[model samples]
Target: MTAISRTGAGRRGVATLICGALAAGGLAAAGAAALAPGAAYASSHREAPLISGTPQYDNTDVYAFVSPDKPDSTTIIANWIPFEEPAGGPNFFQFAEDAQYDLHIDNNGDAKDDLIFRYTFNTHTKNKKTFLYNTGVVESLDDPDLNITQTYDLELIKLKNKRVEHETKLADDVPVAPSNVGKASMPYYSKLRDQAIYKLPNDAKTFAGQADDPFFLDLRVFDLLYGGDLSEVGNDTLKGYNVNSIALQVPTDLIAESKHQPIVGIWSTTQRRNAQGYYEQVSRLGNPLVNEVVNPIKDKDKFNASEPKDDAQFLKNVTNPELPKLIEAIYKIKAPAEPRNDLVDVFLKGVKGLNQPPYVTPSEELRLNTSIKPSMHPKRLGVLDGDNAGFPNGRRLTDDVIDASLQVVEGELVGSKNDLGDAVDKNDKSFEKYFPYVALPTEGSRGKTAKSSADTKSALGDGLTGATSENTPLIAASAGAGAAGILLIGGGLMWWRRMRRNY
Candidate 1:
């Protein structure tokens, strides 16, 4: 979100050389001039028209990074069902039972998935007689009062030459962390979330549940970059929203080809069962905003359905991106030259020598170098600011993707150097520091009452003290119930405290 003076055409002269280097298979140096588009963050909340209508099956975002706590492992997180209102009730957000949420890894960088982790969910309602999500104050995931619940199956499918080479069920009937209904219903939401973190073989961990939408940006770009006058910038549009998230952590050696070739490409897809009972790939995401910002309206949905191997069909969109031209028209800034091979390196192929595979098949997937250790102090700007441990290597929860994307699109690579951003620098809430790094979902009771336990307890205490001796027993009982409700909400405080310690 910062601005800087342009260095002029002195830098622009290198574009041709970059293209030449790419053609001559010497792009390692040329591609190093700028950060990859993988760091250019775009929130795909209802990005395409068709996918917009089906939020449950829509892929919102995908994040990959080396596990900070356990540096030997890699973590991949994917989200769905964006912009969920905390108060939206009766039928709270849930994963699509008929959909297969999959995370794909192209270890050999052939633009084909070598490994796929597929998650399928099943919804359960304990009481058909009640309209409530919980029949009573829910104490635990398996509590009978937690009427509506869900469990999921995790399958690890290995592939070769686009054919299923082998498939193994990694987890069966794992409890999904339920939605945070309210303080009264889910006082121990964090405990429930911890219970949902199921351990997999080989020191891997998996979690599926509602979470604070980790994406933070001013989505007002649809309104001509904030009413076309830059008046509407700086707002975190997704402030209070939530999303259903799935997170997986595994050993780096498991997905990488070898320590000699440690890079891996990652992406996610949603396959929904159609009318004919066939599962169709409806949504796909790798880099933050490829489909949302790069592809045009006509190709957005198609990009979602297309595979990385077939990415040549959409090369023109990247070479002649429309965003720069829009900036040129609106703000009188110059667009980068066409046939942007630099963009190809940023978007399709990984940045040379950084995260790119040796024989990468020019595709759109988040290519991560697993050998890069986690940063001791991460910079929000990621690789642009020399934090190789962050985005462009692989996105972390704290990476400032929107700002990076804006600067890159405005010609940071082709020498039109300037700091362009939406002014939204960070998420509304701090991300968790441990595995399954997303923040907890906003409760349905959020903003309805005092969040602090001390406040709630004091208010209930005052009520009890004001009661007459004749009615003291009744008031004390009511106060006891109120205090119990306060304890339930206090559990959230305990979770935050724990997070702070781990963080």
Candidate 2:
């Protein structure tokens, strides 16, 4: 798991401005967004105390935004299975068949999911004789030579007062994209990945497969926290790591069903069936990095198990977080004062005019406005850069959330000045403009720092091959989240592949 650290503030300042064009004094097509806590580039990776044990069900990050290509549709992407080594094995990472992956929508700020999309997977091995992911993947998704395969089913359900009132399984059996082994086996990996995109009856689209972990961050927070050199902090720890991604593109009308409430709250969770046949919720994420950075050791599991409605209980920590104090103590930088209503306005209760609902109890959920128009030149600084189309409004793959959040963490509120950063600016790979906007996963066949067909070489000749070396050991969970010391992300000083993110 990649550990999150403080983001460096940037050239511009971000403010709590809510800009959405409401229609007829009702929920209309307008640009809007909610704020989430920003961690270092790692975002959420095995953060919870209990859920850390279940890596398959562990969610890394969640993203929701208005589609830049298809403006009418909203794009939602959730990542799982973090810090995946490209050459891990004959049996690489696959979604657990027993685990239920969910993307939830709360159109109103009631802190409850009104619409829920659930998915489950099943893996099949065509040939058990040899331990190979693919015997000879020479062709399409259903190639006969494709020895190992995985398929999934998706269901869209509606909840009224948290009771299941409606549920519908999507028409087709979703095919899970095979792991990018190598150019020798899966020669044309992009074509194979594109085939995984499935269109639904409602004109919605969904995809479940491997993708380049879109998160980028400097993992040097460990050293920086101890007053290390600022230039050294520029190294990105998450570069070249791959993650499992589930993306959905649905109409704005579907998410914003209530005409009165255009603003919707979004979050993701994973559940697993216990021996008793009862499903237990193991992991949950809304606002990024809260469980990993804010909660105490004893309360991490409790925070994961609790719902957004009960988030009021966690307010004290948010108002007076320990991270900034640590930064102040070590680096001598004065952070914001406690009883941080600014944070409450930015994260929990969405900005009054911007993303927050009319009546809401402060909860940590990524808030998005369905009506917001897409920006042609989307800025990495998001709302701070006046690119209302970015993070803190609705998260986009290109948004520099780490830097944005770092500015806020260090008291760079509205009408303030600042400049902080990790220097690693973009994702390892370029993002697509259309459905399933996340880029392709770095091939699993590549050794640590070893280049693959999917990887473009950097100026230093080092590809984004983060911590894939055989010598790299499995990092401990406690080293990753909550009150237990800051987590360790990928090893080595990372070298990023500079790419144009604007699509």
Candidate 3:
């Protein structure tokens, strides 16, 4: 969600005494709510029945690592609302006012965050008195196309309860007033978004904004196919969507102990209540929080009901997914493995985009051996590639995750090779060199009249072919008559089964 939409919600009130007690006891207040003892599990991505409705508060993806560009710092990137539309205006997205957005760093492992960076946004909408459809036009503002403006403020906080604290810091903890760029500057929203950066100490920097989403997965096809094998859809379908992002670049010394091996786990959250009576509720959390696939339940409504502060609770839910058992029972899949340990591992540490048989088993969280220093230009090998830069460490936009995951699941890492063949890297489109790196085509350039569906399909077809046709089956199979039929049948069965189940 955009920061501008979270205007005027009051700050959060102090937690209830019970919550305070839990916090004091070192227990996650959100996890107090227990789950059923022996239930099937699933990934947190679209697991929650409540968050499926409210995409903004949904925590999609989280990333953390020592910045390769700056050896002295760690960069944290969180994305929310996958596959966002560049022109989803009229009523665009925004974060929840009552939500508390946070970036958690686990300086000391043990699966807990040591240092936390908290952020909150306050929004204000102006020119409410105007009645025109386009408020910034000369006729509406009685001036050139610069009259309509929207503004917002931000706050970043640091915490060290049971963890180490730094003696010195670079950036001040204060609310920043971001500019209100209307239509005239619409073309420069990318630039305006970059201008919102808040530099940190030791040349650290941070920013939050809406940008063309960097993730590339054929979500529509996946949804249509339901929980079927996504291998057949190809990656090009994920191209060109948008998302909201929060990026922070910090010095490495602060993130790691001695720079020899700094292990940090990155996660994002949004809170609805503050220490004070102020209750700013978050409507969204994490990068690509809930836009990738279909939610069989009331997806949109559920998404609106969630908040990042509820993460511990979300974890609990995934640890014991009630829906998977239901799916197993309905499908009669041997009643599923007892206790549903599958989901626990995936939520904690499974590699992204690599789902083997029994996709819901729990595994260890992605583990990055920082001891293995990354090459300046490491081959973009994914998790299965014996490279540590992909999942379990931090996910990058260009990682060929699908291939890596498939190989690993097929036991390739264990010295067995089973090819799912090859596919394109949809996110390979070059990113910006600096802050707010995602760049998407402008809305005007992407409108229906500007680029029809047929045109897009043709363009995608041509692009996927060319010199790399031998590597991608989507291109090689484009003209195969029976391939489309087989895909349709497989996709249809999966879709029907998924739709038949009740969460």
Best by the TM-score measure: 1
The predicted structure with the larger TM-score, 1 or 2, is: 1
Q: Write one digit per residue (lDDT tens) for candidate 2, span 65-169.
A: 988888888889999988887777688889998989999998878777899999989998876655667655435789755667788899999998899998998
Deviation of model 3 at 178, angstroms: 9.4
For residue 280, model 2's alpha carbon misses the true position, in angstroms, by 0.9
Better of 2 and 3 by TM-score: 2
Candidate structures ordered by lDDT, highest first: 1, 2, 3
Q: Which residue ranges in model 3 land beyond 4 Å of their true spot? A: 1-47, 131-185, 220-232, 235-237, 273-374, 414-416, 421-424, 440-503
With candidate 1 superimposed using the best TM-score fit, by how many Å does residue 364's alpha carbon deviate from the native?
Answer: 0.5
For 1-503, candidate 1 gives per-residue lDDT tens digits of 22122332342243443322211111111121222322222246887899899999988889999999999999999999989998899899999999999999999988899999999999998667556786555666887667789999999999999999999999999999988988866777889999999999988999999999998866666665333455435678899999999999999998999999999999899999999999999888877765665667898788778887887776666666666666556555666676666666755667676887888787778889999899999877787767777776789999877666555655677776645555666899998999899999999884343344444434434333242454346557976899999998899899999999998
lDDT of 3 by residue, 1-503 (tens): 00001111221132343222211111110111111111111113444665546666655555554456664555677666555565565455455556656666544444444566665555444334333222331222122232232223333334465445542333443222122223332434444454467666558787765655565443332242323333344445446555566677766666553554355545565555657967543433332222222133434334334432223433434334343344333323222333434333332433333311123222222233343354455433344344455543455655544343333322333344333212444464676655534553334233222133333334334333133432345545665657788899999999999988943
The weakest ten consecutive residues by lDDT in model 1 span 23-32
TM-score of 2: 0.80
| Alpha-carbon RMSD, candidate 3 | 19.3
Summed backbone clashes in each candidate are: 0, 15, 65
Q: Tell me, what's the RMSD of every candidate?
A: 12.8, 14.9, 19.3
Each model's lDDT comes to 0.75, 0.67, 0.42
Error of 1 at 421 (Å): 1.6
